[model samples]
Target: MSRLELSPNFSDPDAFYAALTEAHRERSEADSERINARLILLLANHIGEQQVLEEALSIAAADSEQPR
Candidate 1:
């Protein structure tokens, strides 16, 4: 199985972030949450790699305040 790549993989991360924020603009909190869930499912499906997804989940679950 391939290892999860932690480094910057997107060609335009900031642009993507801007677009994502734009998508949530003016949305209600519930609507924004639904949008996020849908996006997550779509991306996870596109990834289509069990191991990589699990690793991503583990990393995401880590507390941001604590050292890695």
Candidate 2:
């Protein structure tokens, strides 16, 4: 099982952020939420690794408890 790379893995993080944010442009809350859900599932499917996805889910759940 491969481990999650909790580091700077994106080649162009800024571009990705821009694209993601742009995708939400003029979108309603519900639409944006659906977009996010679809994106997550698509990425997870691409990864095709249960262990890594579980690790990511655990980290995300833990992070949600943190104060922003």
Candidate 3:
């Protein structure tokens, strides 16, 4: 077999995140948004900021229960 190479198109972090969020929103399968929420939390932890992360978690939790 010949070697194959794959590359991600995300040139910037912000653009990558935006694309991720959009894709997450577009998913129709069950639990897709929940997966996205986990991803968001992971990214937030990576970025640091206990206060901001807490605030973001609060907002997300509040919105998760509402109609989309």
Candidate 4:
């Protein structure tokens, strides 16, 4: 078995955010939602706010586990 790893190259946060927003606007609704989600994760990672990201993930997980 083999594993693959992918990483983002974001030299400038502002530029990346602008590009991401533009791409999202050009995408279909579903694709835009997915891109938005990915952008959140990527931006969080780029900001080096691991604690905030972890807390957000935990909250999301907890919410998903609860009944509607």
TM-score of each: 0.87, 0.95, 0.39, 0.43
* Candidate 4 error regions (>4 Å): 1-30
Number of clashing residue pairs, candidate 3: 0
Say which candidate scores most in TM-score: 2
lDDT of 2 at 38: 100
- By lDDT, the candidates rank as 2, 1, 4, 3
After superposition, the stretches of candidate 2 with alpha carbons farther than 4 Å from their true spots are none
Model 2 lDDT tens row, 10-50: 99999999999999999999999999999999999999899
lDDT, candidate 4, equals: 0.71
Write down the RMSD of candidate 3 (Cα, Å). 13.0
Q: Highest lDDT among the candidates is held by which one?
A: 2
The Cα local distance difference test for each model comes to 0.92, 0.97, 0.69, 0.71
Q: How does model 4 score by TM-score?
A: 0.43
Worst 10 residues of 3 by lDDT: 1-10
1-68 per-residue lDDT for model 1 (tens digits): 77888888999999999999999999999999999999999999988999999998888887565785
- What TM-score does candidate 2 get on C-alpha atoms? 0.95
Reference-based lDDT, residue 37, model 1: 98
